[model samples]
Structure formats: C-alpha cells, structure tokens
Target: MVKCCSAIGCASRCLPNSKLKGLTFHVFPTDENIKKKWVLAMKRLDVNAAGIWEPKKGDVLCSRHFKKTDFDRSTPNIKLKPGVIPSIFESPYQFQEHSYSVMDSPKKLKHKLDHVISELEDTKESLQNVLDREKHFQKSLRKTIRELKEECLISEDTARRLDVFCWECCQESTE
Candidate 1:
C-alpha cells in the first residue's frame, strides 16, 4: 500500500492521516461530472453530508483513504437553517422578546423628542422676554427725546447738542 499524507502534495507519509483504525475518509467534489473520476481515484472512501472526505488535499485525493481506527464512533451534529423556524413575532415567547426590544427603542426616542420640545419652548419664552424688554426700552427712549426737545427750545446750544444726540441715536438704531 502506498502511504500518503492528508495534506496536498508532500509525498512524505510523516504521520498517520486517520485518528482511528480501519475507517478511511476523503473529500471529493459532489458535481456529477467529476464525481466518477474522484470516486475511481480514491477507492475506499464514502462521501459525508458535505461531500467532503476526511483527508482532502486541494481538489484531488490520495489513493489511501482515512479509516476509523478507534472504537469510539463520532458523528457530525447537523444544524437546521434559521429560516426553517417561524418568525420571532409568530411564537408568544419570541413575540415578547421582540416586543421588549422594540419597547425599549421608542421610549428613548420619545424622551429625546420631549426634551427637544421643552428646550424649544424655553428658547421661545426667553426670546419673547427679550423682545418685551426692548419694547419698554424704546418707549423710555421716546420720552427722553421729548424732554430733550423741550430743553433744546430753552437754549440754542442745548438744541445743537440734542440734534447731535438724535442723529447718533438714529444711526445706532439703523445699525
């Protein structure tokens, strides 16, 4: 019997490929066109669920196959696809779990929106207060202008000073 390593193209049989005795395995392509050639080359190996033989080297197989050498028999555990089970919302247990996650989401969003609205309301109130103060200041300014004009009528120098002050006030207001 020609001895071969489990890996691709070393030709040196440095170690035993199979962990157990008498059972040999190899991986081969499952495609129908290539299956016959693979089966013919690796004679004693059977295809597993994945169509892989235990000791596959690249795409080809060595003549010697991996065989069961130990008394302990181990089989691969198969897993089902996630989609095979119903959607999370379908089962009551799943629905509750999903609902809990969704429930947590909107609460934070609602809180943030509420906080933003409160901030906006506070800003609006502050702006209105500022506008009210400005209106009162303007009314007091008009009264000061009437008093200045009355003082200007009493003296020409006072009239010149009042004219200068009025022009400065008008320029500042435009700015």
Candidate 2:
C-alpha cells in the first residue's frame, strides 16, 4: 500500500508509479510518550489548526522536518535515537517575524533565560576543571626542577673534593 506524509502543509505522497527513488516514509514512534511529544511539537507548528492534531498508527512525519543531526545516518538505514524530539521546522519567517513577540511572554522569557543560565554554568565548570589541571601540572614541573638542581649541586661538590685529594697524592709521590 502507498503511504504519504502526514505533517501539516506537506504535500509529499508515495505512489506505485512514481519515478522518484529512495524516498521512504517514517512512522511515528509507537511509544505513547514519544508519540505525545511529537504531537505537541506538531501542534506548535500548526498555525492553521486545520485538522485533528493527534497522530495514529499509520501517521508519518517526513524527513524534511528533521535536521541531519537528528538521525544516525552512518549506517545504511537511518535511525533516530530514543526520546529524540523533532524540533527543527520549515517556517523561518514565522519564527523571525514573531520572535520578539514570543519572547515578550514572561513565562517563555523566563524559560529561555533559565536555559541560557544553565548552559553558562556548565561552561564555567568545564573551564574551572581545565584551569585546575593546568595549575597541578605547573606545580609538579616546579618540584621536579628543584629536585634536579639539588642533585646537580651535590655531584659538583663531590667532584671538587675528589680533584683536591688526587692533586695532594700526586705531589706526595713526586717528592
């Protein structure tokens, strides 16, 4: 049986007589939670709300809505990791035009700010770890240099005493 994309405004359809090759429809995940998340994401994109938003067993979301990073494309067959939500959408104008208006909502602004703050904290922690490692390496290098210098001084003192003793013995033998 032929299948078609169920995403809103998508006109893709699969037919037996079609000349196009390698076009495959991906069914929504069977897991109820995952399916619900996909439905929520779709609802966000559907400005018109033309039809029932719920997805059923046969409903498919085409590859166009997803980014390359969303799928594991290394193998022959494309696969999505479990719990991965499709966030990328085709409407750039809607986001660009209404971004400020959307951000004006207090709850959304707070949520976005919280996300940014969390990311900044993670970066700060990582940078601190790197600095701590560098400090440890510097301390070890200084200790090694000090030990080597002490060894060199001791060797020099021993060689000097040996040279004096040999000179005295030579003078006594000559006499």
Candidate 3:
C-alpha cells in the first residue's frame, strides 16, 4: 500500500510515477521525545478523545512540510536533518469549531460570511474529488506497470524465437 503524508490537510503520497516525484515521505521517529515533537508539530488529536494523535509505525510525513535545508544532500538517499520538524501546513478542514454567526448577530454580515463559507466548503469538496481521482490513477498506473513488467519477461523458448526474429529482421534490413 502506498504511504501518505501524515500531516493534517496534506494529501501527498509515495507515488513513484506521480508528478509530485519530488515529494518524499519520512517515517515517524522511533525515539519517544523526537516523535512527540513531530506529533506536536502535526497539531492532530483524537477527536473523540483528549490525547494528541500518535502515529502508527507506517505513518509518514511528506517533504513539502519541511524546508529545503532540512534534507541532507550528502547522502545518496534523501534524508532529514536531525531533529527537524515539519512546519508547513494548509488547514482545509480546520475551520473554527463554531461559526462566528453565533456570536456576531449582524444578519447582513452573517449572510455574506455564510456565503463565503459555503464556497469554501464546495472548493474543499472539489479538492477532495481531485485527490481521490489522483489516488485512483496511481493505483491503475501501478497495476499497468506491474502487468507490463510481467509481460516483458520471455521464456527461454520465446527468447530463442525473439533472437531468430531479430536475425531475420537484420538480414531483411541488410538485403
């Protein structure tokens, strides 16, 4: 299964064929202290409960949340600098728990505000639809690549036939 960025409001995932090839995911730290810091930066919590969100072992954060300097270029594989925390975030669903219409009783202002909020919700839904489509595309692409890889391998008999076919082509070209 493809790992997605654990950061709230981030939709980046590990799709090798995706346009977001630059997107890299880092596993949550094993150390308790560093892990806590990472979780704190995430600003996520169990909605039904009080405690902060604790990531499972497979959970990861995408590179977009980190600064360019956070990566260690000296290493062949991209790696995070020690103790770096993800700071970048976009809260698509992080609206206030209560609407201002409750407190600010001006009906005219409230109507305009509600209209804007409605548009925001529609935009958020559209974004979610796009992400879902991308996920489907990734799954389909992976399946196609796997099938192509499987089809490319020739049995010994097929390989011998291919060699003969190539030789015939070469003779035809020469003639």
lDDT of 2: 0.67
lDDT of 1 by residue, 51-149 (tens): 544434444333233222311344552222221211111122343455333466677779878999999999999988876776676667656766777
- Best-performing candidate as measured by TM-score: 3
Those runs of model 1 whose alpha carbons end farther than 4 Å from true positions after fitting are 1-104, 153-175
Candidate achieving higher TM-score, 1 or 2: 2
Candidate 2 regions with alpha-carbon error over 4 angstroms: 15-23, 44-52, 90-175
Between which residue pairs do clashes occur in model 2? none
C-alpha local distance difference test of each model: 0.47, 0.67, 0.76
Model 3 off-target regions past 4 Å? 18-20, 91-94, 97-175
Could you tell me how far off, in angstroms, the CA of residue 19 lies in candidate 3 after the best superposition? 8.8
- Give the alpha carbon lDDT tens digit for every residue of 1-175 in model 2: 6677776557767666432554556789888898888877765443466653776678777676676677777888877766878775555455555665344678878998999999999999998887677556556654555565577844655555554555565456445
Worst 10 residues of 3 by lDDT: 92-101
Q: After superposition, how far is residue 29 of candidate 1 from its true place, in Å?
A: 33
Cα RMSD to the true fold for all candidates: 22.2, 18.5, 21.2
Q: What TM-score quantifies how close candidate 1 is to the native fold? A: 0.31
